[model samples]
Target: MSAGGAHLKDEGTRRQVVLAGGAAGLISRFCVAPLDVVKIRLQLQVHSLSDPPSHGSAAGPVYKGTWSTMRAIVRQEGITGLWKGNIPAEMMYVCYGAIQFTAYRSTTEALAQLDPHRLPPSAESFISGAVGGGMATGATYPLDLLRTRFAAQGTERIYRSLGGSILEIARHEGVPGFFRGCSAAITQIVPYMGLFFATYESLRPITTQWEQLPFGTSDAAAGVVASVLAKTGVFPLDLVRKRLQVQGPTRTRYVHRNIPEYRGVLDTIGTILRTQGPRGLYRGLTVSLFKAAPASAVTMWTYEHVLRLVQEMELAAEA
Candidate 1:
């Protein structure tokens, strides 16, 4: 193919990946959204430091586990609680997934085209995933922050509703409020995605050799493995990110709410550790892991299938 033709082809494929990734994200978000709500609730729980827990604030109900959290949400806020902030979550997912896959695919393809003989697939995936994850997080961060706040709000809404939340944040906290935890988000997502993709690439050969599997199945398996490992390593960062996001809309003039007014990523980290203990950083680790496994599986499986479908359609069109 001519250079111009090749460029067009590359762009076309990138767009296809974007669409496929968006579809995958939409599907996966719905599948795991309840768990997502539960996880955020768990993460946002601020245990009182008092020995008798006598902070004068009503003691937040302790969620024993996923099932209890689900029960609590359903009982308190109805079934709708399971899907709190779903709109923003879905939007963030679609944008984040589409941008991530598009950038990752484009970068990887370009690198491979430039030096096919040098870099391995795992290295390529890692580099592309890292860059793409950072881009995706940065591009869709406001939506992410909004989603976190909405989910954390539940029935006792801080901002009353979505439009209210958006306007309130814009009016009170300004533009940067939308990106309260940008650094922490980037720190959490970039390496997590890089490691996840690299692990997936690394496992391809091993999985295929172990047993004959369908295209998307292997991808699903790899995604599950990668998600577990990556999530475990980086749960603390994610917890900190969530706290930072909620700080923006929930802060009050009378009393600074949202845990010591997080200065930055490191400050958030230290504060959580020093005050809440090491366990504080892993508050929602259980629910997060539960969400990660099936969510990752669905996302990767659907993404791979949709990507293949797109490729086939593109090839047919070209032919």
Candidate 2:
């Protein structure tokens, strides 16, 4: 590997990596949309998971657990309910994947030139992943906010369609509305992605040697481990980001009524701690872990194989 970077030396190869990353994102999003929807529902709830607001009966929380939530969504909102915000979600994933991989590849290549010997592989991976994740999060933040809004709404439709949601935000919250939780998102994603890639790269060699893993390939297993670990570490920030994004007039439309208004990041965290306790910050973490495992597996598997395929095609074209 020269200072210029290994496989990404050429424009053609870099383009291939970007496309592969996009495909990986698309596939992963489709596979885990239901878990994501459930996760958001649980995150937005004001009450504890174990207890529900007494509505004059022994009814449990609207979303109790992963399986129960899935059942509830299916029963009330039909099968498609699980896919509430999939349209914007998919768009965000594709763009995010493309931007993230390319930025990561570029950043690593640059680091190779600047301080290849000085920086450890872990540090390089962390820096590159943080750059990539930050770029992706910034570029696709609006879509992310829209996806959250769509997912937050229940049987009572809030912003109806994607275009309508955009218009509603524009009408009320203005252009800045699209970037509502972007700071929190970037803060959460930067370190999370850094840790994710650092962990993945660190574990990949060991995981690959294990022949009995579920995917028969080490990357999938490594991805699962990395994602679960990384997600757990940054989950509270993620929950906060979701809460911030759902602020404004749209909050009234969501099923989780009576959500306390947050002034900013610290205030939100403080409010959660004061009102709901530390456990409240981890709301929906169970479903998030479930979503993270398969999403990471699919993402790593797809990105690797697709990149290989594209490289092979490029070589064949040259040959």
Candidate with maximal lDDT: 2
- Listed per model in order, the count of residue pairs whose N, CA or C atoms clash below 3 Å is 0, 0
Per residue, candidate 1 scores C-alpha lDDT tens digits across 1-319 of: 6432232223356678888899989999999999998888777766632234323243533455678779977987899989988998899899989998888887777776754364666677788889989999999998888888777764566756678878998999999889888899898988899998888778755665756676538878888999999899989999888878877537432111334577889998888888778988998898899999999999988987888788888889999
TM-score of decoy 1? 0.87
User: Looking at candidate 1, what is the lDDT of residue 247?
Assistant: 78
lDDT of each: 0.79, 0.88
- How well does candidate 2 score on lDDT at residue 295? 99
Residue 84, model 2: lDDT of 94
- Over 4 Å off in model 2, which ranges? 1-12, 53-60, 115-117, 214-216
Give the per-residue lDDT of model 2 (tens digit) for 1-319. 5643432224246889799999999999999999999999889888776786444222445667789888988998899999999999999999999999999988887777764354777888899999999999999999999999999887889877899889989999999989987889999999999999999988888887887776456889889999999999999999999999899977766867766788778999999999889998999998999999999999988998888889898889999
**Would you give me the overall lDDT of model 1?**
0.79
Q: Which ten residues in a row have the lowest lDDT in candidate 2?
A: 3-12
* TM-score for each candidate, following the candidate numbering: 0.87, 0.93
